[model samples]
Target: MRSPFVQLLTARRFAPLFVTQFLGAFNDNLLKASLGIFVTYRLAEQSGLGASSLVMLAGGLFITPFFLFSGASGTLADRTDKATIARWVKLAEIGIMGLGAWGLWQQSIPLLLAALFGLGTHSTVFGPIKYALLPQHLGADELVAGNALIEAGTFLAILLGTILGGSVVLFDRGALVVGGVGVGCAIAGWITSRQIPPAPASVGPDAPRPRLLRDSLDVVQYVTSQSKLLLPALAVSWFWLFGATVVSGLPVLAKDVLFANEQVVTLMLALFAIGVGVGSILAERLLHGEVSARHVPLGGCVMAFCAVDLYLGSLGRPRATELAGAATFLREPGSWRILADLVGLAAGGGLFTVPLYAILQHESEPSHRARVIAANNIINALAMTVAAVVAAALLARGMTMGELLGLCGVATIPVIVITAWIVRRGLMKGVVRLVLRVLYRVEVDGLEHVRAALPHAVIAAN
Candidate 1:
């Protein structure tokens, strides 16, 4: 644990929120993974659906709520106290998991899917509360670290919950075990949320009752109304699109392209998660806790190049009769190249996202911040859903997975350019600042000149 993380974790204001967020993330993934395995292994035959279809459906079920109900959820978060909403969401989790548990034990697919949707709604509502509360709880100096840690914790939680869900659900008593764990985490989340210091509603109580489509549009317009805020929102959405494409494709990429076994899927997942975690912490250190996107351009560049490497490295790989296990995959020198590229791709995520989120939290109006984040969440979910659809369509059209991923890389340059230009009103300026910030650690007033002037000095290049 880093010294600052230890301090924040031990402190009252941040620790409870942190723990609550972690448990919620863990619980969501845990159920999703359990349901995926349950549907695939247990019901594949009777359901008459392919593994991919069922699994993808399960994933979509988890995300559907965010797209559908974020309008109402975001409004609710702003009108009511955020901590109160967190507690209520956590409490709802317990009930949701209880239904999921019954569904698991009874092997009822519909019940399980319903609970899954319920869980998605729980997250949709909680999502706004989580990011919006950061500014209220932590000081400006701590924003980067706070967002970084959350991102790191979230990815790690997803990794661990996924592993546990996939592992435990294979047991004869898997249903009982998965259910118990979900309920336990939910209970703990509720308890932890209680300890969260009060964050009173910033929006007045007279706010109109949410009209789903209208409220969502208003929130999105609010986010895009500020030229600067649009960048973080768009950049965050793009990252999720890229991320969803990578993660969803990885299973097929591992089995079909790399001809690797199931454990290899787990291995690739760990590398990506750990890479993001490390990159997030590194971002905090480099920026010295200042909220800025100084490194975002560099992060996008790294992802672009590394994604191209992934496409190139995947070429001409030998096919195996039996999928290569993780051990065999690691033994090959060529595998190292693929692994490195995946890490770089994922690390770029942590680098760009932590700062952008910190910037969003720091810059938005306190009253409407939750709605803006809600809009971002909706955009992220929609973009990710699009990634899944596009990958499936292209793969069906005989596009190689490598070509598809390479397209993601090629597509990134424009996103970077457009977002950089929109956010900073200059593209080359962001790159120059990133370069300067990296090359020189020179102090101005004992603080690096990068942050507080995100695209500052543009180094006079552009």
Candidate 2:
């Protein structure tokens, strides 16, 4: 029997879309990584800014567009053919990358930063289209599998892009090489995008028009006003908060706490990303192609445990005499334990997210689904920014990274509880009744919705 991933990979419906998504993610991260390196090494001296500050500024630029544009993007996707928007987004990526390449070649920070913002906008537009388009392309049975493959592919692409970009930027003609890679990937993404079959709009002409400020506010209101949309949206945002914190913290954790070098930092990142990819695939297998949040609470538990364990592990580590590289870090006492915690945390995260995304797509009104997802994106961006600020605030207040991590671990409990509360409370604590009322004829005829909404089976006798 062929796996769903294999089947989907070969299917025209999914393959081209997958390639397009993978290449887009790869190209974005590649440009960002190379830009970061360039900023850190060559530009810091001339630009009168510290290397770390410049990198953070770059990150800010990249994230700003999602905050501002996701609502309009989502509205646009919901109002038109999603696949068409995707192709246009890809075409835009080529020009964005061209600008970025020129920025890199000329060592122009302004052009590079502008390119980053453009890339961010590109991502913002593509985000809702992909999620909203999936339900249209894949079957009920295949939605989980399709989402899994995309999630896995996305993280893997990010990992590879980061590694490749950082490595390629250190060469003699690094700028030129990096530029070529970025532009080439952009063109490739555009090519693959052209092959994606049409996913036309389901909503008719009366759909809401796009308004930048109003749309942003309206989308968020749409999400929060409905408990079903609200739950998954909040949960998704929480995951990003956790993810942004963990990923951002790795460098400091590696260099100072673990006394490890850049290689160790990369290794830690690989473990995190790969673990999420593994868990995404695992979620599909475990759920057997069912879309449900049944295991999300369990996944949250696992994540909490692993995060706390990591904090405990990092607490007593004996700092090395000098900076440790990958090999030495692996051999050090308590290293594997910490690494295991990283994997476990990320795996749990993977398990936690796939279903929530399914919920966002599965539960939403087809007419407004893209807008709902757009709202989620805005919330996610805010959550990540909050995570950065929270981390910075805690670290500045004399908390060690381990303690801050531990704080994050502790924070996970409420997020999990709140997610559960929303799931259960959103339905007024009557899972069975709610399931039958809301989802029975619509989605849960398959029973996945019932199993997903309730924590466990309820048995009552009068």
Candidate 3:
């Protein structure tokens, strides 16, 4: 039998969506990475900002849109056909790329930063539609497999984009070439999106139109009214926070902690990405074609353990002022341990996330599912923002890179434990039950009521 990824890639319903999502992800990273490198190497004198600060600023700008727009995006996804929303978003990407190209041509920092924000806005709008589309298109049994493919494809896209962006920036006129590539990816994504069949709108045409500002403000209330759904969404957000923290620490770890250069940084990133991709596919196989929460605790523990090990491996390395190449770094003792730890951490992360996504989709009511995803996105953006702040504060306060990483690793344990506690108390079921009892005033005695109402109910709180 063909692997799940291959099977999904060949299937009509999934293939087009897959390609579109992948290309979008690819271009997002490509733009960010390319702009980062260009600013760091080529415009350092002109920009008057150090390479590290410029890159950090770019990262912040890219993620800021998600925080600002995901709520409205969720409303849009729920109010219209997801495929239609995707098409429009993809179309917008063409113009966004044009802006980015202009930025590159002019070598303007402000324009480039605006492009980054624009790309992030594109992603925010697409986020709700992408996840919501899967349930409408795929069978319940295929949910895990579908999410696995998207996650794997996304990571692979990031890896390729990062490498391509960094590599292209080395050549003369690289910015123009990068801009050209961005336009191409955007065009390709738009073409693929054209092929996607119309997906169900969460609300009926006769239903009262959702007010974006009002609905966005109500997301927190919606989440709270369905208490069980809250944990899974928070867990998803936490995963982002965890991943961002690790990533934020990497450059420092590669340079100061490990005495390795940029190539080693690339290698370490590649390992993490590959590991997540491999782990996602592996989780699908290990579950015997089912979406189960049983593996989540195991995965969370594994991630925490491996991250700690990574910190330990980074410690007490031989003192050398000179930067080591990839090969030289690999030859040194403990390097393998660090690599293995990173791979293991990423794999564990994959295992941890797939089920949480499935849980979010499966638990949410159809009409509110996209909105729930938007809430998750908002939380994710906030968590990541907080993580960045925390990492920066810790680093500035005389903490070593390895020690900061180890702190984050240690922090994961408590987070996982609290999530597990919430899950065990049957909070997800309780969320549904509470809605039935309070809103519909129906007597709900058990988890059965919650599960029965999950598919069709439009959850709201007075």
Candidate 4:
């Protein structure tokens, strides 16, 4: 049988959206990674701050617009064809990339930051449209698989972007190259966006346009109306907090803790991205299409374990006078363990977040779905911002990157526990079945054995 992802790709409905989203992610990460490396190596001294601090700053800046514009994005998504919104966003990327190109070529930090903010706005505009489009186009049966594919494609794009972003900067006139890549990818994404089939408007044109303050209050009221939904949404946000901490910490972690160079940084990023992608794809099979928050507690526990392992692996290791290149780092003792920790952590993250996205899409009222997604984006952005701020503070206090990550891992436990407690009633199997209507359609071959062992047996299933 063809795999779910294969089937998704074969269908024209899903395939174009996938490519468009993939390209958008690739462009975002490529610009961010390149800017990060530049800030790390070339401009930290001029800025009078550490490279890690600068990275966190850039990350915070890039995500800030999501908080500011997500509500408006949601309004747009609900009000019009999602594909049209996506196209406009992608077209806007061309100008943003041009500004980034100029900023990079001139080594102008302020201009580059402006470009970053612009890119963030671009992403904010597209965020609600992308997730909201999925449920409209795919069946409930395909929700997990569809989301898995998007998550997988996205992180894989991140992986490639990280590698390319770091490698290209090693060349002469790397700034120009980074700028060129940004524009090219944006153009490609826009073209792909054009190919996406039009999505139906969730809100009719004659539907009264919501005022900004009203929109925000309405979303909050809707989210709070169902406290159960609120918890899952927060759980989703916590994933971003956890992920942003680890990813933003990696470059410094590689350089300071592992005593490695950009290539090793690239390796760490790619490994983590790969792991998340694998875990996202596997989530569909692991749960056997039974979508619920049942797997989240386990995933969070695994992430904590990996985080502790990472800390232990790097603790008390000697810092090298000269940074090790990727090859040399790979040969060092404890290198594989560190790699494993990164991968494991990312895999756990993938497991933790996918079900929540499915829940958000499948459970929310269709009329308010995009707005809910926008709420999610706002929460994700705020959580990431908090992570960045906390991480920055911890690093400024002379804490090692490993220790900060360990703290992040530890912090995750309570959030997961609290979220689990809030959604505990849904943890039961029967509740899960009810929560997810027609969750799965699986046929087991060995059912006769169970029947023979005990006729009319009381069986519990998900």
**Structural similarity to truth (TM-score) of each candidate:** 0.92, 0.91, 0.89, 0.87
Give candidate 4's TM-score.
0.87
In model 2, which regions exceed 4 Å deviation? 421-462
lDDT minimum window of 10 residues, candidate 3: 443-452
lDDT score at residue 157, model 2, on the 0-100 scale: 88
- Candidate 1: tens digits of C-alpha lDDT, residues 1-462: 457777788889899999999999998889888988888888877787897788878888889888788978888888888999899899999999999989899988888889999999999999999999989999998889888889999999998898888889879898899999999999999999999999998889898777787888888888878866887888988888998788767888998889998899999999999988888888898777767786787778888899999999999999878999999999966899999999999998889788989988888888788888998998888788888888889999998877888999999999777656555734465457667778985323533564457765454422
Model 3 TM-score relative to the real fold? 0.89
lDDT string for model 4 (1-462, tens) is 888888998888899899988988887888888888888888889988898777767877888777677777787788888998888999999999889889888887888888888988888878889899999998876888888888889889988877777678657999888889889988988898898889988887886574664665566667868865687788888888888788878988988888899788878888998889877877787665556777787678878889988999998777788999989988999999999999999998888888889999989888888989888888777788788778888899999999988887888889778756755776575455655655665444665566456766766776
> Candidate 2, residue 162: CA error in Å?
1.2
Cα lDDT, all candidates: 0.86, 0.86, 0.83, 0.83
- Global lDDT for candidate 1? 0.86
- Local accuracy of candidate 2 as per-residue lDDT tens digits, 1-462: 999999999998999999999998998899889888889888988999899898989999999988888889889998899988998999999999999989988999999999998999999999998888889989867888888888889888888888888888878888888889889999999998989899988788798778887898889998999988898888878888998888889988887777889999899989999889887888888778876777677678778889899989987777667899899888988999999999999998998898889888999998888999899999999999999988898888887777777777788898788767655643353456557678765332446666666787674544
Which regions of candidate 3 fall more than 4 Å away from where they truly are?
Answer: 1-3, 48-53, 206-213, 422-462
Q: Which 10-residue span in candidate 1 carries the lowest summed lDDT?
A: 442-451
In model 2, pairs of residues that clash are none
Residue 8's lDDT within candidate 2 is 94
Best by TM-score: 1
